[model samples]
Target: MCDTKHCTKNNNNSRNNNKNNVKFIIREATKQDCPSLKQLIIGLAKYESRSLETLPNIEQLEEYGFADQLAKRLFRTVVAQLDGGDGDNNELIGYALYYRNYTPSQGKGMYMEDLYVDSEYRGCGVGRALVAQVAKQCVDAECTSMEWLCYGWNTSSLDFYKNLGAVDIQESLECHKFGISGDDKLAQLANKTVDQQSIKYKIRTGVRDDCPAVREMILKFTVDVKMNLNKVVTLDQLRDDGFGDDKDSRQYRLLVVQLDDSSELIGFAIYYNDYSLNDGKGLWLDTLYVKPQYRRSGVGRLLMSRVASEAIADRCHTVCWGCYAWNRRAIDFYEQFGAINYSLVYDLRLFAIDGPALKQLADCALQ
Candidate 1:
């Protein structure tokens, strides 16, 4: 017969140990949790060693948590509450804040705004649980993919994100504010100051006649860049091929960037609606390039702003584009304009299969 007393004592010890272990529950943040949320934010900021120049006070927290319409519409904050078990006082342990960031080219993708865990909960599964929650939220919102940025110095975060299949786009060069700041003072001077006479810009729908010039500009801009221009065709060819006798080809629209005074083309964008299995309806910035001399003269910004407005007018869910990883300037410019990088296309290739046998082999390899 088994020793009942020993077995009972062991079971009791196991239950006691389980009770002492950290346990947490995650739920949607309520307005009442604003104080706890604020504390958590402050703790996170302090832990990250950020300057308190923009720290949120109690009043600001109220405005942000309960009153700000824009903030509410843009993000959803979920809190993780640690329960000591047996109905003890629950404390806010961590948070995951995220919002919908759509990629026009890729369909409906989302990006995480912020994900932070308390220092005490660092080694626990709290962070992973928060990320998992955010991902589920993205899927529920019908997002095709999710992305976020991790600091380069934070190797732990980088490794965690990579483990979660996140790709870093630091390799893309983002040339930004070209003429506005830094050594590009000349580019900045191109824009008219408040006292100076403002230069007007003209925007119009591109036509077939503008194809040759636009294509030439694209070729010049991408001279040494590693980009696939297969779908980037001349305006005339696009209209002819896309809307030709066959009604099955993809549909596209073109916008031409021009100077109001000279009516000369500086840049153009080719875009189309993406209706794929993963994404519903998104806009792809197939090509956007301006003359080097005309850059930082408000030409790029004007074109991008107009494109965003046009995308909104067309009821597009999102707009998507890609830039080289080393292009910090371009990345900053895009981010300032509210465009976020939610996905990275890697190792893009262009190929032509000559024979049916080769095509079959390629398909098999893909599988």
Candidate 2:
């Protein structure tokens, strides 16, 4: 957080709904601003050519984001609004929504998920002001980095970020370098017939008996990522986390792909429902992994296909996942599927607070 004294400011050349110039005040979002913030979100989707069905309603946004007594808050938003306006039309011209994302490589950092400015508000300094404030907040929070995905084809924004010194997320390529597929395209991929002469594989839901296999695969995945399991999460705990019958615990769905003639599972994808105030009924792809020997033989693709097919069948608005910046092969594979690689110019980041910091936070009291 920039010193509150330094953060809030008014933009001189701002635009409002009336097309009349208005002073834009950039500051922390308040509870009453949820409606305008939601509108900005929808406007962003439309401008970016995405269906509005993907976003949540204003009431949902308010409850999740602004409910005052929640023990732990999940997200925060900052808004750029007309400082003064008559009636209830105090238009919020822009906003930025963000939260923490954790990755082993970097400690706690900021992930700006949405930053949108009304059409008329572009060119004004509202967007830059919002981001600059967030960047300062990232530093104040002791985060190693702040990251967000940029539209790959938005050259103007790409150049802007390049001037800001952002680097590509996947290849470390700079500035000019960069979804889950849409439901229809995913359906097209899933429904296509495979060649009879090619390697054959089948995907099926994981069962209790398959827990050991899944556990072993997870271990392999950990090693592949060049990280240690640390035994903090044991095989039994992993099994219970997934196969447990408790309704209150998070429920995970696992899809496995294996050869036709054998029972050996070559690939697997683990996903579950991820509902947010902004993204309603989405699918979170936890892990998609294929054995090294079986990769590129269509096992990974088959697993992803099943995941996407199930997502569409279950009415999920989107599927979200992440990849290591160094994994160029996996990056390319996902690219072929038209998965939006956010911020082709700079590798977006995942930030986390864990281990000792997690314990400290749990024990900390309000000052």
Candidate 3:
């Protein structure tokens, strides 16, 4: 959480001299800030030329992000406000919204859903302060990385984030997908069930007892993809962090496919709820892997279908994930289920900070 008392503000001579010595501080947003936040969200939409038809109403925003009845808050919000302003008249210049995401290779991470600064306040370090606060919070919570998306055409933002040490992952990978899982589309995919005669497997929610298998599959998947697994990733961490006492507070949800005959775990998927200013709520499929023999056997499709169902059940409107450009088969698989490759359509790029870069950013925030 972004504790207000400890939140920092930029007050260097350069910032103090900018635009009539404008002063600002970044702190966690409260329910009272929803209205301003919504306005900023709309402003961002207009800046991006995106439709506001899908924007959440103020009441929905409050409930989803600030509801008192929620077991765990859906997302964290921070606002950059003009400092020392009159009481409730303080002007909010920017905001950042983020949530938790987990991967086997990155034990825990933060996904920034929105980072917007009012146009008038751009170039005053308000955006930088908001992101620095989020980065600090990530480090405080022991998260391993922070990730977000950037429009390819937004060279300014791309440069701004790059200066913060964030890496454009799209340069190394192919693209990311936002699967529009409407009810009709979800039904069509789920209806394409696997061929039971060829492979006897059942998909079910995973439990702590299955952590070992999940860990094994995760290592195998990393190896198969020729990617390095995090040295700190561990089975105990998966079981403890993912199956904690407060089920709602778990980092990620698991679904595993097991052989009905031999009772072997052949495939698994790890997805978690995520939110964006534009997309509202969605599911991010961090990992979906099946054994080599199970490729083209409908196992991946069945797993994806379940993911779609889970999204609907959770009232999420989208399913998101990334794929390597060279993985033609995986790309075809996701496309068949209505997943739009945003890299092709919108030229969107994914950015992330981890390892030494993450440490440096977080350390800078603390100072």
Candidate 4:
């Protein structure tokens, strides 16, 4: 939900009214709203040229909308309804579905999963209102930032988002895949040399009490690039989730590196296998951090080697993560490990609400 005070700004403006003097109300969605939400998602899929991949089927919607534990824990959907805007009937005109996202490097963030307005209501400020509502929610949640992707061809939507003060950090978003049949040979070759000699320090599976040290390492790595290290999981949170009786608790695997004799933690790595996609399996290397003094001493390489080997063992087909574009040191390290750049991300920011003016700025390269 949005913070009422922050959302009040410009929300009551007459610009959002329809031709019939109809107003709109933004409120949390109910289970009864699932059908309409599905329709809106389908519409959005068409708009994005991904109609074939439309998500949240009716059954899945019911699960996530009202029943799924994680969904209930993580997200909330708000719908925009017309007060007599829909031919004197107060019907749904649009919706915004968003959830929290956390990365040790990026910190607490919000992802706007879906935001769409009925085509008939396009020019009446519906989109802007939805954005403002999410922004308010983001502020209320105290998130370090908010992010979402807009297609390169969607100039109007891109312009709209930029007008609302979005920063496109796309160039820093790197992705890599591993564990595919052919890739396993490369991974095996990389691992054959992994021995006590290849390891500059001892590596062990993380214990429950290691969260604090792990978090500190992550904070240091992210701080090197001016990124936030938010409170995603504190030591208490880790104990609760990892030690708790939850089926999904086994999803994560964390490893820590330490000096062989001193037993001092100097680095850490976190990875997990995700089964959400149908393409075999997917593995994510969420974080890999080593103390600056220990860096370039094979600590990072040892961590990467272990992660890739684990991905192969798990039968995963992809192992991926992002690196900041300006962090040339990190990029060079990743290249040495055989990771290829799959996409480019562009970060753009808007200082004002003028759509045309923002578009012009986006057209110009950074000086």
Clashes of each: 25, 17, 0, 6
Better of 1 and 4 by TM-score: 4
TM-score for all predictions? Answer: 0.52, 0.56, 0.92, 0.63
Give me the displacement of residue 71 in model 3, in angstroms.
3.4
lDDT of 3 at 87: 61
lDDT tens digits by residue: candidate 3, 1-367? 2223333334431123244466776678999999988899899999999999988889878988998865546788988887655665478889999988898876888989889999987876677777877888898889989999889999999999998889888886654655655567766766677676588889999989999988988898888677777554798899977899887668889999999888689999998988877777878898999999887888898999898888888888778887888888888888888878877788888999987777666654423
Q: List the global CA lDDT of all models.
A: 0.54, 0.63, 0.81, 0.60
Of models 2 and 3, which has the larger TM-score? 3
Candidate 2 displacement at residue 221 in angstroms: 1.6
Instruction: Give the number of the best model, judged by lDDT.
Output: 3
lDDT of 4 by residue, 83-107 (tens): 5543667678898876654455534
Q: Which numbered prediction scores highest in TM-score against the true structure? A: 3
Candidate 4, superposed: residue stretches over 4 Å from native: 1-22, 68-74, 84-90, 104-106, 170-193, 196-208, 226-255, 259-262, 270-286, 292-320, 328-367
Candidate 3 stretches with Cα past 4 Å from truth are 1-20, 70-72, 85-89, 364-367
- For residue 132, give model 1's deviation from the true position in Å: 0.4
| lDDT, model 3, position 324 | 81
Judging by TM-score, tell me the better candidate of 3 and 4.
3
